[model samples]
Target chain A: MFSEWELKRYKRQMMLFGDDGQERLKKAHIFIAGAGGLGSPISIYLAVAGVGTITIVDMDVVDQTNLNRQILHFDRDVGKKKTASAEEKLQALNPDITVNAIDVKIDESNAVKLVGKADGIVDAMDNYPTRYLLNDVAIAKEIPLFHGGIRGFYGQATTIIPGITPCLKCIFPKAPPKEVFPVVGVTPGIIGTIQANEVIKYLTGCGELLTNRLFIWDGMQAHAEELCVERNPACEACRGITTKTPARTKK
Target chain B: MTVKIRFFARFRELLGTDIVTEVVPGTMFTSLITTTARKNPAGYAAIFDEKGAFHEFVILMKNGKRIELTDAAKTPVVDGDEIAVFPPVAGG
Candidate 1:
């Protein structure tokens, strides 16, 4: 039963997209990796937007450090699993939707199957190995992937539409040695919001996407730009690689 | 010849923008940046650190091929090339 108040509350967005947009929202399922900095905003935005279903995958436990930007949890929620805390917050925010909080880390073994289950995925995980796995599986399976990353005063995003756009591997074959680069949590919030925007735009079949174009934002100088990138015909993850789609993981 | 420019992750932040262009002769990839940076200080500062070498995490590419910063000065740019700069990417 759609309520008048709910309709009024969502009128602006509904007006922009119409009943068809609402239907797509009702049909969409989003898989978000990580419940850390980026995941917090991604979760909140998707849930509030009335996405029909969301599966949040993360294994970390909340700590004091995350409170600065992990808006899904609070001081009292510390020591709770991140996926659980985020799930609780998201469900509380939108009782109209389903939030599946999976408390687990994504790995090669489970990457393909887990990703295949969703309509699209938001790359919110904060490391390289998992990023590669996400890129590889997403490409092999021909799924849309929204990628966002933030550190210090900078952040970037790109939309990978499987074979249509470049995968993360074509751009970066290997990850640099991980480091605790200086970061302010809100940076992730900014980028994560854009990631959510891309997800929404992709789901609703809205305007032209960031496909093949990278959106970069810098907080220091308050400047942003979009650069064009093309697919590499020989990309190991896309064209010339012999790889198996990792089967869906044990539920 | 013309070369396309790209920025990713942190490099995009420090530079404050994404794409740039240059219509220079086949100069070294590094020189093309210096030429482009002449008009955009943020782009210059974004790529070359205090020592003028790309920061350790920075990755440079020529027409989609990865190029070591040490050789950026010698990597000749050809027509229709795309040069990319990215901070260490961290995401899944």
Candidate 2:
């Protein structure tokens, strides 16, 4: 079903997953929750990988401070909306895919509506309150939530399969105090790509997902390790939900 | 008895990780961490409040199993235990 240009554009990666996998990527809708450090790499990679629809939401304007890690924007975009900058860059990355960038602060009132029918939600936000909101939406929708967070040279990522694995609240019940957190560009660049990788694996039903484990990255030491994570029976966000669908079997 | 305490992310930076120290047979998890973290006042302050109780947001694990903050004060540490304490990194 691919056009001549489409096949050629995806030729290299298609060799790994074949046309069927490419079709899944072409049909998947991924909702990314930020346009800052993590969002920049996540959306860019997913767009180039040909995810069918990418809905990225961000409400901030591009400040000079964001250029270090928000790769979607440039010097000229300092005053521009992050959504506008992100949409332009993502569309430019893959003319074949659809990129819908919405400029709004994601709150309870509109979180579910914004994520409509998406296959997965990528947690790229900087704060826990919004991340918690996305976790709720993912649990309600019964979709996978790929979570990633970074600070300075340290990063953490985990894939949440709603009813099957630990929800965000189960893993980190209390939100850490928020501040203007220190960060370097490569931190999110690493964690975000892991998140994007998780989305790809989930959509294509290939390889092992990061589920039930927390992947911790220490760029300072160039060491990576995973700690087993379990769902809390008393998790406030997903306690009542049961898995309606079996976990995806690897192809 | 000797137990190894591992700190991650910010805690790792404030208090060095892979800390091996001897503890009494009945040392509680909270007291062990309070003693280890005290090596650095800032690190101690980061993990505990002025009242010397663990910060609610800090995560503790013993032998890879989560130990609830409320239980940490009563949870005893034994020999060869690998304890991990960390703050959830909250940035993009």
Candidate 3:
């Protein structure tokens, strides 16, 4: 329970979401798969908001290149494990919250167990295999997931309400065949913050999350675009799930 | 027969604007990528780099459905098919 002062600190949001939102935030448990660029903002924001629990899974060690974007790690924290360093600082950010730091690459073997333990999963991974891995696991487990991606000056964000909103596999039946790509730091900041916002909105039941719509940012010209995405019956992730029949997208 | 090709996210940047309507069949999704870019290099330079391959971030969809890379050409297209072109998305 947040103290009176603590409650006052979050007054603006509390006034918006009311006590119900606060309770939901305290009841939610989220798994953040990548603690690099995207993971940094999501993990920190969720923690500060007092999400009941946050489990971060990552295996990469910090490189100097991370400094520009990974605000969670400092120059002195360089060479340290990203999950560990992030956990230490995130806990310090909100000691009242719980933070689980798993220092390992999330793969087929562990994705199931991790995602199954959460109410929602946030895709913060770096590559296609892992992103696909997360998509597969989330859809299989029927968990809501918020997805975001940022590269160079471009970024996109969407939420998959499992069986309801279209899964990544529906939008992208297969990986893009490209492993390494270019990215800018702030782009992740922009996209990750939106993801974090989705979590809060969903938890508080305040407003509509970005479902079935791909929100995009184009940095070259610095403009925004939104395109409708649809749930595909042929999607291996959602096909024959037999749960949320006649899935609908919120305009 | 005109197939509408739409671009989203990074793909739009590489190829300015979000859409293009061409009087080409759907089966030519792969063929048109290279040919169209060659015809309008400035409209698609970042889409395919020096190697003359997709720049890694781009994805192609036909009528709202993804065009599997393996069966990209055989993905089938019809008149008035709306093809979606996207770049790999990464936030979370």
Backbone atom clashes (below 3 Å) for every candidate: 1, 0, 6
- Cα lDDT tens digits, model 3, A1-251, are 67786687567878888877787788778989889899999888999887888998889899998888888899999999988899899989987778899987787787898765687889887766788888888777677778888878788888988877788877766455544557778888888899999988877777788989888887777787766788877776788665544222120
Q: Give the chain A TM-score for each candidate.
A: 0.92, 0.97, 0.93
Could you tell me how far off, in angstroms, the CA of residue B42 lies in candidate 1 after the best superposition? 18
Q: Lowest summed-lDDT stretch of 10 residues in model 1 chain A? A: A242-251
Runs in model 1 with CA error above 4 Å?
A1-6, A240-251, B1-27, B30-57, B61-74, B77-84
Which candidate model has the greater TM-score, 1 or 2? 2
lDDT of each: 0.76, 0.93, 0.76
User: Clashes in model 3: which pairs?
Assistant: A148-B90, A148-B91, A149-B89, A149-B90, A149-B91, A152-A183
Order of candidates by lDDT, top first?
2, 1, 3
Considering just the first chain, candidate 3 attains a TM-score of: 0.93
Ranking by DockQ: 2, 3, 1
Top-scoring candidate (DockQ): 2
Model 2 bad stretches (over 4 Å) = A247-251
Q: Whole-model lDDT for model 2 versus the true structure?
A: 0.93
Candidates 1 and 2 compared: the better one by lDDT is 2
User: Which one is best on lDDT?
Assistant: 2
